[model samples]
Target: MDISQESGLVWTEVDLSGVFDLDVDESLELESVGDGRVLAVSASPDVVNNVLVTDNGVDWAALPIPNGFSPWSVDITGERWLILGRDPTKEAPGTQILFSDDRGSNWTELAVELGPFDGTAWIGNAIVAGRLIVAAVQSDTWQPQLDEALDDDMAYEPSEKHVHLFLSDGGPAELVAEFQGWYTGGHGASDGFHLIISGPAAEDYLLHSPDGRQWSSTIVDVHVTDSARNELWTADPTDGRFKLERFEGVFGSDQVLTLPDGIGWMPDLAVGPAGVAAVGGPASPNDELGGDFTLPDISIEKNGYELRYNQPEGGITLWDLNEDSAVYVFDAETLQSEGEFQGVSEVEDASGSNVVFHDPETGAELVAFSGEELAAAVTEEVSAAYSEYDPDEFIIGWSTDGTDWEWQTPQEAFGLPESTPDDNSFTQVQVAVGHDFVIAMVQTYEFLGSDFGEDAPIGVGDSQSDSTSAYLTTTTSPSPPRWFVARVE
Candidate 1:
């Protein structure tokens, strides 16, 4: 179903292939940097030139990266942009921090010093707090010793790991404190007031600091998922069912929410001004089969080959991997379940993966693939497998509230030709939300295999690929993905 023509929702497509190389880059990270602007960085480990900034998400320009530095993460607060990377060419080969005052037009690397320890160090987390830049640095030292067990052979083992918390104010970073433990890097979050760094010992072991200098250590049982303002959202799995808990602070007035049945463990949770939302698929008891959702009995026949798509008595549909996965919305203050919507699965690490974005003027907005209607045409006939389905029909779904949703085909939304001139098909999609707009990244794929001919007989199978093996071998080259900006009024 599509929204009314007068709904005042418009989508514009923006080609990013010229500036960003989506073919070589595995994933893209996007963050809203306020003022209707968004910062995107390509997560290619081997490439250094992969940064872009867009003011409207429709026109994009490349942001230059410093030479000899491979950045892994980018953070921005206000006008300050912090880039954390490693410069292996340095003599000590440790973590390097780059600061930009004018939105990345010029950069300056902060002189970070790791005393005495001669080894490699990398930045696990970095944030811009007001005018001070805080970073968590982990260093690993190699210790070599002669082993007597194997004829005095030389053996090397990593020495004790050290975590250093550094604070800088437009100058060289000062080492504030250091700890000795095995730090699990890449686990951290900031709530605009406090910084929380996880790991170095147990998963629950955390280091908290208000100004990046004085820190306190604590161990919490709940897994912290997101933080907004002064509150934090955690997933509590002590009982048999899934529970979502919100804490006023680390230990303050808290509210516990028992999620509905069929939701998977530790579903993605997000907190915003509008409310809290959790999304995940149903829990699969076994490894080889799907979750506890039943699928419809559908079949199609052509050329002596019966294309039957059936689910085991109590399994999900073969076409929709996220049939039962849903988005559950709740009140921001009372933690009451407002409503729920189905067919939205969670994509890990994407900007707006399983979260709901709150716009003060227009309420909440969410963008995701229409799992049920995505490949509906494939169930009609065997020849339909090779035919070009409408790329713009029923591909993406948008929602203002959790209950009411609007659907649009990619062709209609992006103003593409009714028929793709290159025979490219939509494969994956991800979206990021801003205050006034939503940015969508759609990946297209081209079938490379010649097995799906007009006269070929396609057989039914137990798995999704088994029923249609010809769709497995597809390529993204020649036709790259696309980016779209949607404005809702």
Candidate 2:
């Protein structure tokens, strides 16, 4: 499970069995707790149905679930833990909101229900500017044949979408603001909550919530596809056509697009310090959106994928499942296609002498410019590539030109031993590096055998599920992990 990429630096895995109770099989989702400690939320059972709370990633504690209904998600704010879920019984109309104090030792349930729309409720919460704001879709919108409800665009309110907001409190999550149509994505920034919602269905829109209670909407906004440098990006979706716009503190600016025109079915958009690129769309589209500035066209499967901007150089790269695990790279400024790079390790910077990417299926490491062309390389169905338990080894490499990489292993680069990693246990590592501190989250699957998810259900109510076995199952995807924080010089 090791990625051939070598980060020559030393990384130590601190034991957080104390915080996580040694449950390696749980799908741990990590969030920084303003304080020195980290806030971890994990499943109460083998599946991602229940949730547990941990402060230090060493010792853990359980939260109170009122109706025995598993929580859908928990919102971690500067001061509170808001666990949100739906009551699975007929008595409660489906919605449940619980508020917890600092250590999650106690919880209070509020009367939050969707009334008539119980079956169609999809709720979420995010900490915005030190406040807790909750968003819910009250429409049972869906397509009968669709595997995922989120993709059912026809199910959404064509004329308008309703987005409800709730403020953080002790007794109940107060419903504050309600807007039209459904909110697609929401991100909390310091100014407020930046939300991308469908306006009049398919038209573009942006929402700004100064506080959890108030929301303002802007129409014909930029269709932001990715976030970089504290700002969001999207090809201009105005005039019901394509153009590129960078969303700053506000919307509405001159189109930054310099790509060709008449591209059709453009699903994904990406931008970097260098330039912008659009993928997928009509082969010959009317130049209604492409004005004078021609933004180059970067082609890939026009559906179900997005472009990732390589930082430091602003090059664009994406994995094309249709292309048989092949990764295509395009220059940022010129938008010309670079050859496919497959199965190396970490993404190298523009200046690195060695560039590395990995084979999506085999987890095989391929060095850049090693004369290995993996365009449509055969291995396995690209869909089944990596999972939560499948961990890859990461390394740092140097390349004189970021495009071609002559990767260096830790032993070769820093003179470390061949076996210098923290352990043989395979799990994902999410590291947050600061000026002097680093929080490395070491994920493992050892907890599947542990009794972590086999315990009694958390809720107590007449509406709770009677079958305790319903509460436990095999661990879910993206198995959770314990957090280990250290300082780096």
Candidate 3:
């Protein structure tokens, strides 16, 4: 549970859902469509740039253009066709959207545009209503960039907030809505006419229109901005108490539940087919009484698992996802079995949460509800020597001596490897270390010979074959690692 940044990237799933073969380095993108088949997109499943898709977890076809950086966020139209794109990335500039009429056999360029998106941009929760595509975009101004250069003593620049709205009116990329403030977040729509926003701030500036030209607004409140979307639960930051509130026909007239004062609130709250669940810290005598400790809280309403909570007086609290109902719940602080339970899991005493679930077939997913830090990594090494044949294995390991080894994956290790291929030898390799794991990358040597000759000919061999040294193209020196693991449990 005390995973290093290197260990965090090595994610696993039970079923491929469709095409099951491929090296683990093949980065995958997943979209859960409820009863509908989950969508999995992979760029470089064999090599970066190449795109592949699987439906019903079966047949995988390639995309005409190789999938580029962040080419995985897809919006499925009511029709079978889906809207795919080159999601914004710090490494890769610009943003683009592609339309796939056929499952994924072919695609048409919908639109492309320059993006000011960065680590703070919220593009993941994009929603589609009628013919419009709504993306939670960040402020598009030089102020943010300039802010970094300004002296700390200088006053902070005003924050520019807006939602980039694209409509099918003509082509993709067509600017529709340009509201203000950082992308808070919201979800609700009907026809092209829809009501959407996030965070309590988004509620104030309302934009409802069937066409791009029109917009509107409503009241706003305290913003609930949580990076862990799944753990989108809230509690009073001041007293650490909880109260479940249901958004009634009227905003302030919410149905509030004062929890049994003594229990703490978990960072995550999940609601799905199964039921609603929320987690929090330990319980205290005050938890039963409730007050500020109960002010800001999360409420979930699911079919199977319904739960409400208040910070507890003692012990780690828990919850879980119901596979049958598809509701996601954080694993109990202490593992649970079918039956009545009491007390709580030892929060601080616990090393980390280690509860994960997945479809039985693919084994591609290994979701851990609460565990050590889940680190985001950068590609460390890469090679493009054999574009036709991707190396079957790229192992990451650790050693006190730096020479010994323990095989691991880029997702599992701190620094990951990124490669590019030249005519024969790989042109470049880069390694990136994330929060929880360390990583290393190795590329396969070029087998082709220089003079267009076959094999090594005789002794010294040709230039191409000579270039193929049976050793690592690059090795990284160990250094102080970088990891910031948030304690949500």
Candidate 4:
């Protein structure tokens, strides 16, 4: 697969297949810490998880996971690593937060007081804003109901939900704001100066904080996704169509782009020095097979059932799937269409102002990490930092206008790998971009088809379900999925 057509950069596949003796169905998560360091977390059953750190793309070292703490997510800033997880050893373990100042060498648990809740408390999102760490916490309480009318069958229903915003400056986290409803949705974003936590309650509400301590609430009609510099990117569906908008302040926003017809809502958005890219895909319900939908040089069967096709358009072909998705790129400043590509499942910004797009159509899987001019722009900004300012001190740098800052690009995009992977499927791809390298985690199931027979189990020890038995009985290999990592310099 071509890494970049413009830059002629090719992906150098990294052989991390033997890094951990994990089952094919185990979950792996990656995050790009600044200074060319990438963290990989292998989450297994019963908290037998592994935290691996890589300073370079080729070499990896294992980091200790705090005792009894099953990490749900990890966030890094400078040399500090914050892990949000649950410690089953706690008497009333709900959600626990651990802090490491020396790159996971040691850890200290941050005392978090989530008020009081009968159910579980979860850290929805946590981000490092300058020296202060901000987190959105959500608690849900469920009440058990025993219905005598139905033979006393017990059922649990959500009885209460609460959201809280917490702030900490390398010490115990302090609750700054709390709400009755799940307004924040445990979602938060920061662009150095402005921090926003927004979610759908009775109506959409956004909680904005400038210093992570003082916050103001505003009702928004759009769902804010990512923030960069002083602007916020949101998926605006107010006009009954998928629209991408850039918000300058609380209420001021400019519509960036409206997705094309037949395309569902924009599933992903990535902002980098090069520009902004939005992924729109998987044909809308209105464009199903029965409709009079037409494409150039393509024939459609007018059957009620769903139809999937690949059509070449604008220098790329739609991915061969029941539904098709495309990537729309726009100039960061002009907000004009840069271009669009087909078969791209997700888009992400690497640490050095680089943007990476993953196309999993070709059996080998294609990744495009482009934008050299933007990388230079980021280097210039970081070069202007104070002489004493340590690059390992924080992920974000301070500046006069807040625009002169750096960000540790999000480690992983939520709801990614749009396609589910089965025993014979190989369509899962995850990419993480660092300052010096771009790592792609490609999951392939070709090995599984041969390793396990029709009756043999695959994921045996997993407590989630009897996936092994289910896979052996129900799954058929169209083409077994393959797994590998591609490191691009």
**Candidate 3 deviant stretches above 4 angstroms:** 1-29, 43-69, 80-84, 87-92, 112-127, 134-137, 142-156, 170-174, 186-190, 193-207, 210-213, 220-224, 227-489
Can you write out model 4's per-residue Cα lDDT over 338-441, one digit (the tens) per residue?
A: 54433333344653443333444443434333356434443554355323232111111111111222222111222124332342432333444444445545
Which candidate has the top score in TM-score? 4
lDDT against true structure, model 4: 0.44
For all predicted structures, in order, the TM-scores are 0.50, 0.43, 0.39, 0.50
Q: Provide the lowest-lDDT 10-residue window in model 2.
A: 458-467
Better candidate number, 1 or 3, judged by lDDT: 1
Query: What TM-score would candidate 2 get against the native?
Result: 0.43
Candidate 4 is scored at a TM of: 0.50
Clashing residue pairs found in predicted model 1: 183-200, 392-409, 392-410, 392-411, 393-409
RMSD of each: 18.5, 18.1, 23.3, 20.3
Clashes of each: 5, 52, 106, 9
What TM-score would candidate 1 get against the native?
A: 0.50
Candidate 1 residues lying further than 4 Å off, grouped into runs, are: 1-13, 19-27, 43-49, 64-69, 86-94, 118-120, 140-159, 180-193, 198-203, 224-428, 444-479
Give model 1's clash tally: 5
Better of 1 and 4 by lDDT: 1
Error of 1 at 172 (Å): 2.2
For model 4, what is the alpha-carbon lDDT of residue 208?
58
